[model samples]
Target: MKNYKFIYVLIGLTFFLSSCEEWLQVEPRQSIDSATALSSQEAITAATNGVYARFRSVALYGRDFLAIPELLADNAFNTGAGNRLVGQFNNQPGSHMGNWGTAYFTINQINLILRALQEVELPVEFRNRIRGEVLFLRALLYHDLARVYAYDPTADIPGVNVGGVPIVTQGTLTVAEVEYPARNTVDEVYTFIYNDLEESLGLMQNFNMNRRPFFVTRGAVAALFSRVALYRGDYARAIEMSEIAMASGVANFPADPVSGWRTQVQPESFFEIVFTTQDNIGANESLRATFMSRVFLNDAVAASHGNVVFTDELAAAFPDEDLRRDLIQRGLAVNSGVFEINKFASKNGVPNLDNVPVIRYSEAITNKAEAHYHLGQFDLALTELNKLRVRAGLEALEGITGPQILDEILLEKRREFAFEGHRFFDLKRLGRDIIKPTGNVEHSDFRILANIPNREIETNPSLVQNRGY
Candidate 1:
């Protein structure tokens, strides 16, 4: 309890000192001082805000989550314009995403907050909303960790697949409380996430929080649940939750996606990581700087690293008339030779600053569409898929069935979420090998799973490293 109180004071002070930086890096401790720091509504709100603030780090949605997946799969090519993402693009050993520490750290904060909420008294409405948001966040973090560190339940290699990431729900404040945990089964980790999200939705009901798209809401939870279900091979649940998400009315497909990318907040976003001038990651590290050469959308000169670009194959997949193709344009100056991605082109009217869309309505459509295909509902799948086809200026298909529909669905996912980071995960979840310009990575290869951090394996006797590393 003493440790928890000290950590809360540290977190509170960090928020005042730095808007969102050091607090997340602080080693998570045991629990919150529910009687003091978390006893008031104001303090709880600040703590909750601090939790959300962690998403802006380059390791999370701010950069790695968006850029690394595309590079690891076939959707992108590292331009070598900067010293980032090249290893990921090359699929080098032990060069995969390093989100483990940050994710686990954030998860500890969430656990502490949940424990505090249960002890602290507040209005029923306020308590439910706060608890629901943190629950949803916990689910999101665990799902991401599982997908990266373990194989999908539907696609695990029989002999080579190890296990899911460690499941740690309690906040660690002292050496006595520290645990040397072993990995859970992939299904076990997913089951934990499913339960968290289900409870989160139940708690959030009738709590009409209005911070749509920017913060967690009933709609975002449902939309994310839909995606999670698809990853877990729960087709009916995926379809059901997607309908619930669209019905929530928090997000909608823009009538014009070409112009939507230019908006500060994506019109199709169910949940987005909001960034302000104060939070700007700047030209060297922002998503905009990594994917685009121009500092701003309409700048005359190309003056940034532009580290990643669409693969020649991906650029060719989009037809000449497809509006999405226009988003990939020829570069200028230092980046002149190759085509650069414009999806992150400074939409916030600030150089190298754009809100990162974590999940969008379009993804819900694709998730349901793919789910329907898996269930052999070919006609229903086509009906769901035509929604995106028509939106992307392609003619709707009337006569397509079997694997062909599946192919089209996957292709559209690549096109729809190219720079936004769905390609590798889409291929991964489906047990598809990654085909890249350099070489092809087979589905059964050990490299399919990211290496567990070496330090974790060294310190924890119970922890087992992934096969290759």
Candidate 2:
């Protein structure tokens, strides 16, 4: 499997230390200065590409980004085989560091692009579209950050008092420049993300592009709206946005949910970052492959050092008739018999798959179902979930009331999106406690939001650490 190389330049500690000197001494490669870089159509487009490029970085959407969070949260466990880093994540404090580091890395890139975009000149249509993409990306990045770094707003943390990652809307300055800002309340962060998505939806409404799986589209905006609405507990808006995205005809699931899952960059995907085999973006070398047991038919050599397997609880959630059980879960032959692992990615020998979906249409439908159930529209919720069941080669659920149907819908999401990086956030947002990992050395502190890395904390004094970190 080829490892995808990200094109985006990370503004890491090295950059933060040098920013002052570099900003004073060097002229940017494009245009006269950073300010001028966004003044033209070409520069603005490149800036957009730069922001998109971060999706492929190892820390963000790249290998470790999604993998670490899922692994730490209990959706998947590490085989304790391959990398030392994987084991570290299974431990405490370390997991939070990895999560925070990657998220901020991506956030900094978005901030840089947004600052630059403010000065660019382009047609109204072009500007709106570009701005829309920026806003959407910003919202997506912050949403993930919030989930990883804070407690549930409705429960542990007061909506107005909960602290989240610092709002770095502008690029960083210096180490001394690090000013400590108390954590903005969780509601503030969600409001920021929601406002950004709303702006993106409005800006992108008339903008159309070629059907490129790698880029954001109007459909992507709607899909994001559904997600944001869900987080905000706005069931009606969630249902409306999800339905709108689905009605756009963008999020189709394959006849075989298993095969459909293996193809991460399918046509039904709303927005994804494209990867190529030639570019060393190993599609087969993904986080999903790292968890498969040796016995699975499609297992790859690169993933031979298996890490995590599916919990029996997660595996049993699938009905006997659901093909996804066979597609997603497999038994590994060991001296003790067999262990189950998730098989979302097949070993295609191509190092890089063309795309990794950030948002999909099916997610919209699931979001709609969840919202409907919460809104007391039980029949409507089940009806929406059945759409997924029909595609997955399973019988539609029957004879269940509103609350009962909601439980079914939640379980289905857990089964369907298992190991796809949805479980942890779902657990957090729904105010459900994770099934603690037994016998792990660092078990008790697993649920506490990880602290932002020491480097970030040192440089940005204003950034407050999460409680109990």
lDDT of 2 by residue, 48-130 (tens): 66567666765666555555556656666555655534643454554542555555655665665566566654577777777
**All models: lDDT?**
0.83, 0.63
Model 1 CA deviation exceeding 4 Å by range: 1-36
Compared with the true structure, the alpha-carbon lDDT of candidate 1 equals 0.83
Question: Which structure among the candidates has the greatest lDDT?
Answer: 1
- The TM-score of candidate 2 is 0.82
Q: Total clashes, candidate 2?
A: 27
lDDT of model 1 at residue 22?
A: 31
* Model 2 ranges with Cα > 4 A deviation: 1-36, 83-91, 159-162, 172-180, 262-264, 278-285, 293-303, 329-349, 352-354, 436-446
lDDT of 2 at 434: 60
